[model samples]
Target chain A: MKARVTVTLKNGVLDPQGKAIEGALGALGFDGIGSVRQGKVIDIELGETDKAAAEAKLSDMCEKLLANTVIENYHIDIL
Target chain B: MKARVTVTLKNGVLDPQGKAIEGALGALGFDGIGSVRQGKVIDIELGETDKAAAEAKLSDMCEKLLANTVIENYHIDIL
Candidate 1:
């Protein structure tokens, strides 16, 4: 099975990387940007073919290793 | 203005970071995970209030400074 997990900074969190992107954008003359927040995407390839099993494993993965819940949130997408 | 830009490896690209995350998840007892692909998110704080301007600026940013089009793809979200 294949899945994607996206982890993002929570509201009000300070993201220096995001800030750098914004600055770079301004320098490049991109005027459509208002604000920019940054996050991460994790894609996994698992051996499990069972949908329920994959979800369960991903849940465990996120809670234990994939994300830091204190300042980051995650979304799981099965593909 | 604030916006969020996410940069990710293009399809078929090799992502060592994503592989590390996958290994971590598995070591943590996530059995259902199929795979993990990793990407980065960027946040921008723009001084401009015009939507069109921000977008244009952001577009330029991604093309020149924010993302490496040869290996990565970027998405913009206005907030």
Candidate 2:
């Protein structure tokens, strides 16, 4: 089983990295670009075959270390 | 309009970072974990309203700067 976790900053959080990228894009002649936010994706291949167990375990992983709950939101996709 | 770009390492690439993460998970008592790969997601909001145009521009952005085409593959989703 494989799980893909996406961690993104929550709304109203200051994103200096995103702002820097946006600025770089504009300087590179990418006109009409508005805002840019950066996030992370973690792909995990698990030995567990049970779907429910996998989801529960992956959720625990996210809460413990994969995401900063105060400033970021996460979504898990089992594939 | 919004677009999401997911950048992932190519198969057979050396992924030391992934290995480090796997080690960390094991140290944290996540048994039965197999392999882990880390990627990145860039979310962009564009001023352009046309879907096709937005897709084209985002594709160009990826080729130009968003992704390192040599070792990574990128997928763009228009949302």
True contacts kept of each: 0.87, 0.87
Best by lDDT: 2
Evaluate candidate 1 and give its CAPRI docking class based on DockQ.
Answer: medium
In candidate 1, how many Å is residue A37 off? 0.7
Write one digit per residue (lDDT tens) for candidate 1, span B26-55: 676655555467887776777878888878
Worst 10 contiguous positions by lDDT, candidate 1 chain B: B28-37
A1-79, model 2: which lDDT tens digit per residue?
A: 9999999999999989889889999999999888899999999999989999999999999998888999999999999
Best by TM-score: 2
> Model 1: runs farther than 4 Å from truth?
B1-5, B32-35, B42-59, B75-79
Model 1 chain A scores worst on lDDT over the 10 consecutive residues at: A26-35
Tens-digit lDDT track of model 2 for B1-79: 9999999999989888788889988999999988899999999999999999999999999999999999999999988
Q: Write the per-residue lDDT of candidate 1 for residues A7-33, one digit (tens) a residue.
A: 888998998876776666567655545
